[model samples]
Target: MLKLREKLLLNTALLALVLILQLAGLMKGINTKVDSLLPSPSPSLLSVLTAFGGDVFLIAFSLLTVLLDVRNSGKLSRETLVFLVSAVIGLVIVGVLKVAINEPRPRNHGGFSFPSGHTYRGAIIAVYASNRWKRATPLAVLFALGVAMTRLLLHVHWFGDVLFSLLLAPWVYSIVKATQDSWLPLYRRVISRLGLGAFDVE
Candidate 1:
């Protein structure tokens, strides 16, 4: 397992690289070239898959996963809370960056698109799921990649947007994991005192 400091350093470096690329005016060229290569042959199919990365879908999925884990284990694990909390934080960060940077989407779309929210959600979910089930890592990765590709195919985001979102996943997970480890005991005590101890799984 990676420490929180290492994860932070890695993500910070990647973010710096993205900023440098943007400053050098290379993101546009890269986005245009990549978009040109991926023509949308089946919009409906890709759209359906892309929806899996959306806020509604991801939140619902997370809730369902937590419920299922509770059903099976008779307790809510720290992992579930970590996943949910990290996802919410990631979304907030992306939203704030979108507003602050005010980067426009591809093809004259109105909203900011410096970092793809759908891609970020997809990557975060993939990382969380893979951590829970190691055997599913490949599938999770493919799902994340597919979600990122759909954004380009649909011309909703630039290549740099999706790339950065993808890179942010493990970093978010690592941070959340570390936070959970540090705070779960206190959280458990509070919940247990309130008679909701079933959620106190370590």
Candidate 2:
């Protein structure tokens, strides 16, 4: 568990690191270097691999996590709620940054791509799964790295973008964990009062 002060400090440091990397023009150099070394996989195979980090997969995965908890615990669990809320927060953060930063992709295709959304979701899954299952941390980290690599191979994001996702995930998770104690009970009470007791974690 992270204390609030620790979480704040960590978040500030991450933000500072990414900003410095961007301002120093190191991001473009790294992206170009990585692109030169890594060969893009076949389009069909890349499509399938990248889907693991897309919206459909993540939504299904999130619902499945909550449903499995319901099956075993007979109600929503606080950990599942924390995961869901943190995921939502992460999405919002990414969306706002994408618009605000307006950074173009390496491929110069469509969408603004400052931070890789696919990598962000993958990292979030890694953090949540590792918290729930200590033994799975290595596999979880590999999965997240795979997602990050896919974004680079697809030319949809810069190296720095995915790097930021990797940093942002743990920082977001730490904040969620640190603040959960204050919000969980209020969430429970609100859901209970709304006659949604089955969804209540408390």
Candidate 3:
């Protein structure tokens, strides 16, 4: 298994490369080319797929996964808490980046679009699922890719935006994993003191 530190370093390098491409205007050219290859709009089907990528859908999925994990183990697992925390961190980072970059959407939808939130959500869920359940990795990856493709097909996000978000997922997960051992005990202690020890994993 790859260590968390190794994963973090790899993802950070890839993110830096993507950012450099975006800043150099190369990502725009790439996005245009990729968009040109997509089929004409099929709003009905595209809408359904796009909905799967939404924050609401991802949050529900995360909750469902947590419930299932707890049910199976008969206790809240550290993995579940880590997954939730990673998702929140990813969202905050993406929100901040959107404000800082302030890139426009491909369809002129009037908001920052350097990184697609939907894509990020999909990728983050996929990473969380894959890490928690090794057997689900392939399906999780396909689902994430499908969501990324939907952004391009809908013309709501540039190719680079989706790509960057996809990379952001594993990067965020790695950060959480690398620090989890050090901080989780502290977190558990705080929760216990707050009368929330029921949620803490054994």
Decreasing TM-score order of the candidates: 3, 2, 1
lDDT of 1 by residue, 1-202 (tens): 8665876897879977986786577788888898777776778988898998998899799879878878889887767778877898888888887887778898897899978999999999998888888999999999899999989888889999999889877677777787776877787789889998566684
TM-score of every candidate: 0.87, 0.90, 0.91
Give Cα-based local distance difference scores for all models. Answer: 0.84, 0.84, 0.85
Off by over 4 Å in 2: 1-12, 23-26
Clashes of each: 0, 0, 0
Q: Between candidates 1 and 3, name the one with more favorable TM-score.
A: 3
Worst 10 residues of 2 by lDDT: 19-28
Better of 1 and 3 by lDDT: 3
In angstroms, the error of model 2 at 33 is 2.5
- The sequence of per-residue lDDT tens digits that candidate 3 reaches over residues 1-202 is 8776777888899999998998788888888888778776877999899888897798789778767866777557877787788888988988998998888987577888888899988998889889888999999999999999988888888889999999998888888877898988898888789887547775
Model 1: how far is 112 from its true place, Å? 1.1
- Error in Å for residue 20 of model 1: 3.8
lDDT tens per residue, model 2, 1-202 = 9876886798779767996887677678887788677777777887788788888988999999878987888787777777888889998999988998788887666988888899999999988988988999999999999999988888888888999988888888878878988888888879888998668774
Q: In model 3, what lDDT does residue 83 have?
A: 79
Query: What is the lDDT for 94 in model 3?
Result: 86
lDDT of 1 at 10: 77
